[model samples]
Target: MITRHFIDVPRTDGSARRVHYRRCGQGQPLLMIHQSPRSSAEYAAVMQAWGAHFTCIAPDTPGFGQSEPLAGTPDINDFADALIDLMDALGLERCPAYGFHSGGIILVTALKRHPQRFTGMAVGGYAIWTPAEMAIFGESYLPPFQPSAYGEHLTWLWNRMLEQSWFFPWFDVRGEARLPGAHADVARVDQAVREMLESGDAYRAGYGAVLRAPRDIPAADAVVPPVLISAYFGDPLQAHIDRLGPLPAGWQAQKVDTPADHHQASLDWLLALPPVPAAGLVETPHEGFAHVVSAGFDGLVHWRGAVGETATVPAPGGAISLITGAGIDPPGHGLSDDWPAAAPTDRTVWDAVFAEVQRLRGFAGFDFEPITAGDPHHLYPDLTPDRFGSHLTRAWSVVRAGAFFRPRHQPSAANAIAFDSTAIAPDRLAAKHLALLQARSARAYHAAYGRTDGP
Candidate 1:
């Protein structure tokens, strides 16, 4: 069942702020924080699915939805405090949460100061900014709210909204903008606008709060909790994605095609992750990529491809590998090699994996320096051929089983035993191996190097 209601939550600054909340299902609590220019209403569909497994609670922060704005309107830190207050008001000791854009920044604040208050977090489109990137975002972040009496504000708002819809890297307006045809679902767009209009001051407060808020989330990576990042196309949060770089320890970022898809993807991710154990040894990878299934690891799921390509799957148990395009020389002459040191510093496991496959296919290697970036576990299937085969299979087993191995010391369980093929004993091992290889073979290929076109 789903229920929506309004409750007053106290702010850190001694004011009562109104909070609009939607509750559904009954289980471990899951809180969702909405992005700016959006309210909790955006999560309606998502809460329904997530409610099946969790007691979903989505709240409009102080300045959004039915919520009253903070009196003095403090920064994001103050907003974070209000969210925490909402949790306390509801008698929640701890909760898991999902946030996007500005909301992600707010949660990062909560995680940093009140780590124990959260069970886990799923952050979508976290904006980590480079100096130049921040400069660009600063320009786009807040276009004059109520444009000076001239219709200039309205024009900018209309074009900005429409143009932002296009894929990012908005370079030239060489082409005209594209909006859904008349036959398209006008209702959704109307609904979005209606919410914006009805909110009145809520809109101003929220947008203004966002504008005045600090451009960066302090100690973002240091916030300790199982974090999953879902970044989609046209996501204004790309700056956050870029700033994350290889991602900090215990954090993972996945790239998706759009924001709407993140709810389900994030839910699946949260459900798949096991919570942290209180005592028993907790294993974490020191180096290299390993498929992880825990709240602590980031889910690097990505959605990328041209139309009409094969659908990709998440690597089983969250394992990843080095996959590269074909035509690269094998581990010598600047080509991919078997050992790590043999590979160039620029090359990543993805390139190394790609090089390995190409070597198997008898392709000539090229002098390509690898650009290794830790893709969220979710992106593994799209980028790696074997997804969860032997190469990744060995790595995943170790991480899950929590057994430390020689040559590398970390708490990783061994799934290699389960993955091994005996050809044929009492167990149709050869058949199992054949099936595994076949699935992987479908993904192993050499395509245009460096560009994320598709399979």
Candidate 2:
């Protein structure tokens, strides 16, 4: 089973930075790094595939996922050091690592700086961008991506990611820049766009560092771990193997026919290497969240304050706490997991579920106040994606309305909420926007709650 975790790593400035990661399988430890604008979620399938031979550990790079962003503008070396920091925090003295695309760049940089920290590396693609190519990318590749008042950014985001699969550099549209496997897959594009939305403006930092990084490999004489660099036939970086002037004695680079072939080759190479014992792999305790698995439910429940202490669930457009002695996001809400199938329409089921959650958390009881929406249908808009991405605007409208009215769907004087400029600020609205996106089953959960009032 795959499990999520958080670890607090102390910084030089006496601050603690929390990192979120996914861990699965059990064997020798294998550290996996994902590409830019993506979280460790990208490696889910790969982790499952390699789980039999290695305990796969994949983490979101700083600023890109639930992981906190680095202070100020950080370069590629800072990213490399950040990876080392995570490894140190996890008590991993050394481990075999794997990376792809920009992930490979960070791993390569880490190997150069701290060769002893890794036994070996299997990099899917090592980019060696030419000066002319960098010049073109520098001008138009990465623009500042910030949320707009009306969600105009979503349109551009969808197109940018969609076309990325169509062209190298993504911004280049000429005949020569077109990729052989250009596609218009909506599901694929939607996933990529959602990841970008999750990263927000932080994408510029992580991706920019990759573009500005030095492309040279370590010197032939330098002592380092064995590295295997490979790219598939259709990959744009496949041509870069020629650009790699010379590799260290034990390093090798090659091209494969397909992604499957590349994965098999990487797996074969890593399996041949001497295995490192994964002893003393430590995981920090859950600080700000709790995991609950009860009858008909299994998911994470985020909470604040000490167990058994006064907990508060803040209500929308109201300052009062609805439930006391633990603020928990119910299944299918906030960061909690979605219901596996259709949500149970029975109130007794929900009551038993919450009871189990309370018991697991060691809470004696919870004080509940009835929370209702006047028009439940309109309260949660249909966020289904359309060709033009109009759902984004609809979601933004609901989020903005939430700040001004008691029942976000109704905006009369009776429902008027106190005007607070801070609440409507773009950053605040953007946060709520992200929360809405992440709450995949909010509509179903709300409907289930409403079904308790059967005719």
lDDT of 1 by residue, 25-60 (tens): 766778788877677878878888778787778887
Whole-model lDDT, model 1? 0.49
Listed in order, each prediction's TM-score against the native is: 0.51, 0.90
Q: What clash count goes with each model?
A: 37, 2
Quick one: best TM-score, which candidate?
Answer: 2
Best by lDDT: 2
Provide the overall lDDT of each model, using Cα atoms, as 2-decimal numbers.
0.49, 0.77
lDDT of 2: 0.77
Pairs in steric clash, model 2: 311-325, 311-326
